[model samples]
Target: MTTRTPLTRARLATVGAELADEVGFEHVTASEVARRCGVRVASLYSHVRDADDLRALVCLLALDELADRASAAVAGRAGAEALAALAGAYRDYARAHPGRYAAMRHRLDPATAAASAGPRHADLTRAALRGYGLDADGETHAVRLFGGLVHGFVTLELAGAFDHSDPSPEVSWEWSLTALDATLTGWSTR
Candidate 1:
């Protein structure tokens, strides 16, 4: 039997995230991850509980990354500008890391979800909405609306749904942001 070297949980998570980007998040396996790390499968058990745990860890990593990007993008901006910045940041991150982006949307155990960077994401969204004068309900609505648009556009773009379009994905992305800004600005209380 080959000797296995110990890997830290952080190292394993980084490798797992990279592997997810390589072969798709769903295809990531502990054995394969261990192989990539030059360690035996058994060695990974000491760092990660199993495939589920690794996936959750990956989700956490993705969430934190996305939150950081969004926060940075929206800093020193407000209103539609801030919204556009945040939306663009999210789309840019997702496009750059499709597999990791998918991992961010993966459902996690309740405890994991509660403890993950999800709250940070929510706070970022809420902060972005401050410029729009959105209250609690309006902020929630804006969040869902923006989330749907980003998710829908990215999903379609990734699946080649816009490949044959004339305007190009980038152009459409800009137009979408413009339209989103208009919608948020004109939101009605009725």
Candidate 2:
């Protein structure tokens, strides 16, 4: 007889994340995850409250993972180099794990969002923007702007929105970074 492996919240989440990558974030239900783990849906309830909880766990996991990548990408770098590193991290991660990328965008309660690595992502962005000489308000704005720009580009690229166009996504991405760098460097004067 085969012994069943013990299930835990973390393991369930890992499986859910993998499933998300395989199927899609929207389809990652507790039943599906349990099936993949060779267990029943009830088995997951002890570890997770419900499907929403499972998804939330996956979202938190994705946030932590992405933040780690972004942090490492920006380490010992500054200015345009830092910007490119940070953006590249997001783009690459999304390309590698589109489902996890979608999970990272999942809505979280305020407390959960505060406790997750979501803030680390913002902090990394703030640090990356420091060399641009932006004031507090400027830095805040830059963080939002940069996040939107990178996420937008990645989302579009993943959806094949750029596939039919000339000037490949890479070329457009590089151009966007250049423009962003120039704008940030001259932010104070503007």
Candidate 3:
């Protein structure tokens, strides 16, 4: 038997995310992750419990990456500008890191989801809406709306949903941002 090189959990998790970016997130496996890490499959068991564990770690990593980007994007901005910035951050991240982006769509365990970057994401959204003075219900509505809008557009954009159209995706992206901004500004009215 070939000797296996040891790898840290953090290192394994990082490589797993990279693998998810290369292949589909659902395709991520301990064998594949180990292969990418230049190690035997058994080596991975020392780091991750199994493929699911690795995927969960990857999901957490992706969420952290997204939260970091969103936080940076909204720094010092207010109201619609911050909303646009946050939305831009999500769009840019998804387009650039499709696999890692897909990892986030993977359902994480409840405790894992709560302990991961998800809360930070929600906090960031609420903080961005702070200047708008929305009521608690309105804030929750805005959060869902923003999440669905950005995610829906990105899903369509990735699946070539806009390829057959005459309007360029870039134009549509800008238009969407403009519309989202308008909606956020007038959200309390509806």
Q: Report the number of the highest-lDDT candidate.
A: 2
Candidate 1 lDDT over 1-190, as tens digits, reads 9775458887887888998888899988998888999988998898888898888888889999999899999999988888888888888887888888889888998888988899888889888888777778888988888889989999899879999969989999999989988888888744
How are the candidates ranked when ordered by TM-score, highest leading?
2, 1, 3
What are the root-mean-square deviations of the candidates from the true structure over C-alphas?
2.4, 1.2, 2.5
How does model 3 score by TM-score? Answer: 0.91
Backbone clashes under 3 angstroms, per model: 0, 0, 0
* Alpha-carbon local distance difference test for all models: 0.87, 0.92, 0.87
Best by TM-score: 2
Clashing pairs in 2: none
Worst 10 residues of 3 by lDDT: 181-190
Model 2: per-residue lDDT, tens digit, 1-190?
9997789988987998999999899999888898889998888988888788899999999998999999999999999999999999999999999999999988988999999999999999999999988888889999999999999999999999998979899999999999999988888733
Model 1 CA deviation exceeding 4 Å by range: 1-6
TM-score, every prediction: 0.92, 0.97, 0.91
Alpha-carbon deviation at 57 in model 2, angstroms:
0.6
